[model samples]
Target: MTNASTGQMTPATSGVLLVLAHPALERSRANRALAKAAKGLSGVTFKDLYEIYPDFVIDIESEQAALSAHDVVALQFPLYWYSTPALMKEWLDLVWLHGFAYGEGGEALKGKKLFVACTTGAGAKAYHAHGYNRFSMDEFLRPLEQTAHLCGMVWEAPFVVHGAAVKDDAALKAEAERYRARVASLLPAKTEA
Candidate 1:
């Protein structure tokens, strides 16, 4: 796989870690489908935050271990109030610690890849300068991009399913398939021994 920003080839053994953060995943058609699609792919470790941490008490050591094990970290979530869910924020605050993810001696995430996949209730048109949201998706995702940079992680182009709430069954399925393919493409190609 080639890095999206650098146009450089990635290691053949790089694995992927997909973290899904949806508080009400059962009610979200888009997130559920995407999670199902991603969970079946090879070289991907999928985790459902809400399912594992219903109490919002995250295991910092386990989360850090998962991050260290994978070369690519994909965050899958819905646009909750134009940002990640409260639990995800809490996890980041706790897991991404000063000496682990940043600051002095915090080189664990360096050279890793960060990918963001999100679903928005409003359509693409609604997230423009003159649209209802008055900001583009890129604008809203700046913080994540910056976070990736701060941790020395390469930022990949985000995958978004706009107007997710209104997409019909077929459209939603297609989006999920596309997301699966996109995530798969990020995985390193296996080599025969």
Candidate 2:
């Protein structure tokens, strides 16, 4: 892939796949910025679920192939009702089949890594036991962690942005950079050869 700003070519095979899920991306400032940052990075393959499957009809073989081609899979989205967007859930249900993800001959994701990068409208304090949400982010994210465990994949600590709807421009930009850096860190290191 080519670096948008540097005007230079980067490695096309980064072994990193970032799947983004947002029902209405244009309406989201934080998600849009993060998506741009992720797409600009080198050594990463970015796929927008909503954009690709607007009709909610996913191509199973293509999705599976993309997953099989990458070592690290990053799921990016805005937290909706304390869970992923509807399309993301659908994608999970359809693409992550029993035989392909967690049964006999379902070792495609084994030993790989799964990471979540999400933005929440509420502040971090809202996710506490005594807070409005009455649960921690980790608690809300348990399902995904368990999914990784079930698939024999390593679960990395998530990258979260609280108060997604209210961040100032500077804060938003910083979050985007932070996200890009975090995703880039997951890319396989280049060899000296």
Candidate 3:
């Protein structure tokens, strides 16, 4: 708990947990690479939510336990309907219990960190004021940010790769590299006073 009380993350930080929730990893490109880069790091836990609960039945207890074990928690998936995939929503609703994630006595996530990495079929230019998506990505993500705040977690700037469907391998690789680094950078202090 010493690390949890300090706001500085050491190389010995507990771990980074990446939760993957894409509907189909076999058909994915960008998400796949991003998840791959995060795999096998000593202090990293890569959990594929969809793969575990394909029918959308999230394990609240297990997930809560996972959350309790990590310093940095990443929610990685494709952008759907301007937010997260349905299973993710279901997962959130079930796993982020009131007394655990947020409530009068809920402090399980206090001082923890949240980071999001997503890809969209509509390129970067589309998620703007007049773009096809009609709103900035950040704007679409307010609910999530507020949720993190409510749970006493710190929200990091999202790492997004728009136009995911058609980006070339090199382009996708570059984005993946950025995603890896960004995820790596999210390892915050081990403890927060």
Candidate 4:
């Protein structure tokens, strides 16, 4: 995508890798809708973590290769107990190793971008200081932000779909469209090869 201020196309050689992690994909309406929306976009790769590794054994080398091939990494999941699903956490711990993702000689992800898209059961109003959940989504996602920092990736503002459980069909579809647009917007403009 071209930057609005500079009118320069973003230098994205590889494209985006959208990693989806939902323990129960069939049971999650919001996550299903969101994933469906992002399925066929150009320059985007959609991967389902649970589907790939049901045994909870992640392929670190493969995961790192995928990351290396993508200019942007998008994590899509349903918020569970204010954190990510167990498999997603496992993927992070296993794939983002010290020598590869952080510590000395860990410059593999230095210029990559990290984006997060999450669905929450509670409404937006419930994620505030005076609200029921008692913390904003950004606050809940601090760990992820820090992870990006440590990996030397640029942390993008997250895209959140709140009140997912109660949203009507129309609202859910609208949210899905919004998600599609957001993901598409991250793509870099076409350049001559």
Candidate 5:
């Protein structure tokens, strides 16, 4: 795929694991559009956490294996209650183990890239100190950044679709395209041997 911003053809080497965490995907237009945007990209692996682990039973080994195979890990979700959905939290707790994600021997995720692509119900103006939400989106995402730090991963800027609930169809489509481009950009260039 060609990157929209740089106009460069992204090689297949740019492996991205997009972990989606929307609890009720059927009910969300924004997330569904975003997910559709990511579908069938060359080196992008899409995993819906809620669908894969409906009972909250995460396969630690599988999750770890998936992480190990990707250069970029993107968490896609809706900002629920100012944080990730409960299943995402649970997945992190179970998969990011002491010896795998952090601690003495946890070097598996070192140098990997971590990012979040999320939707927010509130508008951009509502996410400031003076706004009703009372905090910037960046502020609300600090914990995820810190998690990347602790795991020795590179924290990339998050892709946020603000005011999702009220965006018109055109706006939603544009946002989804932007998201697809962002995900495509995360892929590293292919080096010739």
Candidate 6:
């Protein structure tokens, strides 16, 4: 599959890891439910960054090992200041090192797939230029898109749930179900088994 930003591509593979980094998971109803689904599913690893490294001292080797084990890497978070949360950015900075994720001899992530599952407070209508958010989701995701390309990984289209804050519990549950299906469906067949 071709990345949205760079047009670089990689064939899909098995075993997915959903890296969740929500600063306020306590207040996250939809994301928490979606993460619960991933936890229930066998073979899909849900690594909650905030819970794992509250001090921001990420273990690089361990993080690299996790990346190596999974064919599909999902960056799951709420759009904070139109970008990833602080710890998530720290993950990219610390874990995606020059000789590991990119640069010379950086073949670790080649052929792997990276996807973003993001939440926005505003509805879809507000993402347009004429709307309040003033930019498309794709536009907001350029860093991830280019980063995936540099790492020789395929960037899948993001799975986004807009207007998450005021969504009813029933609606959130249904959205969670759809989120589960979407993540499940996106998994490589071998992993799906």
Give the per-residue lDDT of model 3 (tens digit) for 1-193: 3445576563433678888889988999888988898765556788898889988877789888889888778899899888999988898899888999999778888888888888888978888999988899999999899999999998988888888889999998898788777776775544444
Tell me the tens digit of each residue's lDDT in model 5 across 118-164: 99988899999999999999899999999999999999999999989
Candidate 4's residue-wise lDDT over 1-193, tens digit each? 5667888985545778999999999999989999999878989988999999999999899899888878889999999999899999999999999989999988778889999999998899999999999999999999999999999999999999998999999999999999999989887666664
The lDDT of model 2 is 0.91
Alpha-carbon runs more than 4 Å astray in model 1 = 1-13
Write the residue-wise lDDT of candidate 1 on 1-193 in tens digits: 5767788876533678999999999899989999899889989998999999999999999999889988899999999889999998898899988898888999889999999999999999999999999999889999899999999999999999999999999999999899999999988777653
Q: What is the C-alpha RMSD of each candidate to the true structure, in Å?
A: 6.2, 5.1, 4.7, 5.5, 6.0, 7.7
Candidate 3 vs. truth: CA RMSD?
Answer: 4.7
Q: How well is each residue in 1-193 modelled by candidate 2, as lDDT tens digits? A: 5677798886444467999999999999999999899878766889999999999999999998888878899999999999999999999999998989998989888888999999999999999999999999999999999999999999999999999999999999999999889988898887643
Native-vs-model 5 lDDT? 0.91
- At residue 129, candidate 2 shows an lDDT of 100
lDDT of each candidate versus the true structure: 0.91, 0.91, 0.84, 0.91, 0.91, 0.88
How far in Å is the alpha carbon of 94 misplaced in model 3?
0.3
Clashing pairs for predicted structure model 1, backbone only? none
lDDT of 5 at 35: 92
lDDT for 146 in candidate 5 is 95
Give the range where candidate 3 is weakest over 10 consecutive residues by summed lDDT. 1-10
Q: What is the lDDT of residue 119 in candidate 5?
A: 94
Residue 28 lDDT in candidate 2: 96
TM-scores for the candidates: 0.92, 0.92, 0.89, 0.92, 0.91, 0.90
